[model samples]
Target: MSKDNFLKGAAILSIAGFLVKILGAVYRIPLANMIGDTGIGYYQTAYPIYTLMFALSTAGIPVAIAKLVSEKNSIGDYRGAQRVFRISFIGLLIGGVLTSSFVFFGAKFIVGKLENTNAYYALIALAPALLFTPIMSAFRGYFQGRQDMTPTAISQVIEQIARVGIGLALVAVLLNLDKGLPMAAGGASFGASAGGFFGSLVIIYIYMKRRKKIRKQIRRSEKFEKEDTSKIIRNILIIAIPITIGASVVPLFGAIDVAIVMRRLQDIGYTQKEASGLYGQLTGMAQTLINFPQVFSVAIGASLVPAISTAFARKNFSEIKKTATSGIRVTLLIGLPAAMGLFILAEPIIKLLYFSNPLEVQESAGSILKVLSFSVIFLTLVQSLTAILQGMGKAFIPVRNLIIGALAKVVIVYVLTGIPGIGVKGAAISTIIAYVIASFLNLRAVRKYAKIRFNLMDIFLKPVLSVAIMSIVVAITYNIFEGFIGLKLATVVSIGFGGISYLFALLLTSTITSKDFELLPGGTKLSNKLKKIGLLRR
Candidate 1:
């Protein structure tokens, strides 16, 4: 893939990811307001079970397809590419049904292990989502494999929109009906099914619209016969199994928090309600807030998956090095400032967004966010690095690293969370620790396999310096304005000011240049304007 096109693809997905996240925040902030901490606990506890199922049925197969298809398309084997998609889609659908059934029929047993029996209704409500999510994800993976990020981006926004609107509407309905928190939480959980169904429709519609064109293209390229179905499935399984195992391990972080945190707290003599509230603070509040900042890394990392696959297929080591290096640099450039800003403004931001929640809950959540904020840098690094490894056909490396991290997290959570003074904050700490370990291992593997040397200046120092400057701006902006506009409005203004200042800081340090912005939509025009004003390199 061309560098410019690759970066542009990442930008498209990044914008879409950010928009989806904003919609999520808009939904969940209000949902939290309506449900309170206990209700949030139920919602979050149930959500992970859905996420686990979604990951299992969807994660490994699409990735395997994406890589396989990219290799086929790179060689002008469009027929082979289409065959891979057909096979993977069928497999994904079957897997989706089985996984969905497991969750639907086994909700009680699953939640029993999670130590959150109140999530039973939520899990039941969410099970249908697994049926469609794998299908939606399969289509997304196929499109991404073709390097057409637009369809996937469009589907993401539409999916999140359906989720937010339907979720809140159901939440309002169930609450108005005087249903208890569990049933009301289940209403909110059903939004995942609505979203997956709608998202699947969007992609299916797009695919149907493009079917004739794909067929026509395929007809023109009868270069080689398609591989046998068994061979294709075998190739797919080789890649998919490791990825599935790895991706499955990822949600286990949440599961670890779910299983360990509440029970550990209770073991230390905390009441069930208190332990549940703490769990909600970590998962419901902080986890939701942290997700928005990750769009940059997530977008670039996802784009890297297929891009790296193509490069690896062509034996283009220089291209792989260039792209992987760029991914890491960009991840850092965005992640550093995001983590610092979140750390600096964690309290006000949490309070501003979750205004309807009790002060105690909000404050407790703010503290959790502060500790978790630093993980932004580490986790984003892990994400980009893992993508690099996956694209280079080393999928199991990340799985091994992540599993090690998760094991460490299990130990940390067991030990730290039971401390009365430490409580749920320990879970946040463990997340960072896990990412630190995983990122280090992934980066080491990338360097060894890809034979790339990273410039600390580009990937680390400049970003750190820029973030240092931006943090001062954010802290001062909030402090100055809080006395006049109140903490909520001050938080808003500080964020606006902080964003602008970070841009200027980046420009002043030559940390980000015209070349980088040129990858974004309207970036060329913005670069021209910035150059004319002397803010960008000529």
Candidate 2:
């Protein structure tokens, strides 16, 4: 794919991922209020297990398939690409079924070991999602490998729309029935399964519609070598396993925290109720806010994989360098401003988002969010660099780095949370340290493998300066508007001003130029308009 095509794919996925993150916030915030923090604790406990299983079952397989297919297609081996997909599809199907069964039948045992028996209902409800998501992922991988991002983007929005609508509706209905927290949380979990089912159907429809064209390509290809099914399967596994392990790192740490956090809190003299509530505040509220900014990184990483893989297959080192540099630059551009915004507006953001919650809950969550905000940049770097490494066929490097980071997190969480006054703040601090270590290690690996020179000024300094300007403007605007309007309206207006200020600062300082805009979807027209308006320099 050309650079324009690569940017277009990233832009499409970024927009879709952003929308999905918004829908996710819509689902989580209301669900938190309806179920309360303790209920959110139960819900979050089950969620980690589901995500870990998801990482193992679906995450790496799609990436592996995408890489394999892209490599084969780059050389005109269309038949070989199809064979990879076929074998991967069957492998994922069998794996998904087994994992789903394990989670469903073993739900009680799993949650029981974590000392949160109430999570069992939610676990069981989430099991069916596993059955469908792998299938959807296979179709998405196939399209993405061909450098087409529309299917993945469209399916994501559909999935999120279904998830929010069905999840909220189910929770509301179940709450009226007074089935208690576990059952209500279970109902919400069932909505996820429902969404996955709908998403799978959408992808299936897309695949069927394009099947004739896909087959035509396969039939038209001549003088191409084909690999046997077993060899294709082996290649898929070789690529998939390390990627799966690296992807699972975060979820594995999350699962560890689910088992450790509340139990340790209770061991430190908090009651079971207090422990669960605090855990909910940390994971449900603080972590949810942290995830909002991660959408951009995830989108960049997803787009980078196929682009870099295809470039690497063709031994196009120049394209690889350009793509890697641009990916890192874009990641820093988005992540720095987001982290600064979250830190500056942590309390107001918490108050606005969780206004329905008690003042104490909001305050507690706000404090945790302040600590978590620092993680945005590091986590974003870790994600982007890991993708670059994966594209370079050094997938195992990230797995090792993340494992080391996770170990540090576990030790730090244990020691700091055990302190008399620290409690959940320790977990937040530990998260930052973990990501910092992981990101630094990943960056080193990227530098070693890709041999790309880092321009510190372009990546960090300019963005930081722009964010500083934006922060000052935002603070002034918010303070002035607070007296005229309420907190919510003031917060909204201030954020709008901050975004605009940041953009103008970047433009004025030449941090963002016409070239950057040209990299975005619809960017050529936008760049022209901006140039006409004196906002962009040619």
The residue-by-residue lDDT of candidate 1 on 350-464, one tens digit each, is 8988888889988889998999999988888998999899898898899899999999999998899888889888889999999999999999999999989888887788878
| Backbone clash count for every predicted candidate, in the order shown | 0, 0
Provide TM-scores for the models: 0.86, 0.86
TM-score of 1: 0.86
lDDT values, one for every candidate? 0.85, 0.85
How many residue pairs clash in model 2? 0
Please list the residue runs of candidate 2 whose C-alpha ends up more than 4 Å from where it truly belongs after superposition: 1-18, 66-86, 142-154, 205-229, 301-329, 390-393, 450-457, 524-538
Clashing pairs in 1: none
